[model samples]
Target: MEQNPPKSIASIKEKLKKSREREEECATNLQLLRQDLIKARTAAIDVVMAHQKAVVKLDEELEENAKDLKNVHVHFLSEREALLSSFVGSLLRKEKATGKTPPQPDAPRFVAPLHTPTILCFLRTHLGKPGMLYCGRKVLECEDFMLKTNRERMELLFAQHRCFGCFLPLSVAGHLKLSDCPHPRYCAICDSKDHHQILCAARRVYQGVIPE
Candidate 1:
């Protein structure tokens, strides 16, 4: 028989082969792990990018909603002004047809019958010349429920009128009627749109309403 290979050498060779196989298996496992990590990182990046895009879209939608809300508010205010103007015009037309002298805005005495119209007047003092400005009459005394208190009725009447300054006609709507003025809706002390002459508390006050 051929001389047998040295036992020690045979054992050493077997161990070397086993170690190489184990190294190859480890290398394969390491490569697979590296590939798995790369995939995981790529998926995480995609998720972050999607989240960022969604956030940007949400902000844009919110901005659009805000603009729509602002537009609605402006529209509502404009419509309210138009309605008030239209109501005043209607009253003026009624007066013209009846040939009745509607209650003057500056008259001190609140002498309007139920459902009678009261004119709101404005004076353009800033136009280099003091000119009388009048808006169409707005109806003050409506044939509605009888108010209980004098103060309540007075407040309601005041609410129907407006005065601009210590001396302005055609006040914005909702001026308080001055008790001291000759005209029903005018201020005697200060031609203001909101308060009585006594309560006007202005440094300068108008003495009386201009003669019609």
Candidate 2:
């Protein structure tokens, strides 16, 4: 009976040892799982930060592109205005010296049909008038003839490449023409909308410069 008791005690001790070993193994597995979880969390955070940076860079690039496009548009408009002014000035000098209106250039007319009447009206009012020069201003009273005339008005009227009223290029102007507002008037030199030639600021400045 004593021997049997000893064997039972030894068996119990062996079971206790095995139980402790199992506990240690479970703790090790839990620690490894915790480390894996921490690594996963770190990786996820890094990915989110990288994604945010990419988005910010994309936004910056888009803004820069928009600015570049705007600059290009402004440059194009200025070039068109300068070319038109030069062409008209040359034509006027030729016409005045020859005592006859010159032939119209064979350039492609890009102005819309709806805007044609307005251009024609402007031309009829100012074309071939005496003592008039293309100085990029609206009509003013001629000191000699007492007649209201402006050669610059004709220059802007024939500017089919852009709107002299709003200074919008043809591509944008074609899409934005107002159906209700036909025959809109503007200063040829300054591009002031809904203004008359007589009240044009540029005309006043030009008149001030004339030697009385």
Candidate 3:
């Protein structure tokens, strides 16, 4: 004969309730893990986007740098060409100027009015004759009012470079039409600061032409 199974129904129901609670807890844990994985994937995607943005920014910066370099190169080349053109123009202008005649210096200076030696008045007043009449002689023989010593002085101190027909001594001032010289007062003929008997009027008259 099969005896009836001794059954604790309350214990059996309690075990079943515990198993359902474990299964619900496992499902909740799985859902939480899936949510955490989705959040991690989203974060990785955001990081990749950030990296891509950085790369794009770098590419733009490189492009800008290249453009700047190109502009600088063009500008420099243009400047160089302009400078070359300017230099060539300057050379052409120089050549043109060189082909023309050079500027000339100023002309020689023209001197003033001519000097003509006319007869002086000292011999007419005092000696009654020109100084030429007094040849190589003592001063007193010509009735010269100067003393014997002065006559000797005239004879010794001075001599004739030329027998100027109408010339007078530079010392005689009153009617002596004298002339000056460009050289230092060193000429032997005129015996004055001006020119000498070399250009004196008596020589010119004797030559029959007034010195121009």
Candidate 1: regions farther than 4 A off: 1-5, 106-212
Winner by lDDT: 2
Off by over 4 Å in 3: 1-7, 100-212
C-alpha TM-scores of all predictions: 0.47, 0.49, 0.41
Count of clashing residue pairs in every prediction: 23, 0, 3
Tens digits of per-residue lDDT, candidate 3, 32-134, equal 9999999999999999999999999999999999767755654454345346545655665787778964344395221111232333223323434555443
Cα lDDT tens digits for candidate 1, 98-184: 999888777542333322224332212212343643333332322121211222333333343433222223353334444444443
Clash pairs, model 3 backbone: 181-194, 190-196, 190-197
Select the stronger candidate by lDDT from 1 and 3: 1
User: CA shift at 107, candidate 2, in angstroms?
Assistant: 18
Q: What is the C-alpha RMSD of each candidate to the true structure, in Å?
A: 15.3, 11.7, 38.0
TM-score-superior candidate, 1 or 2: 2
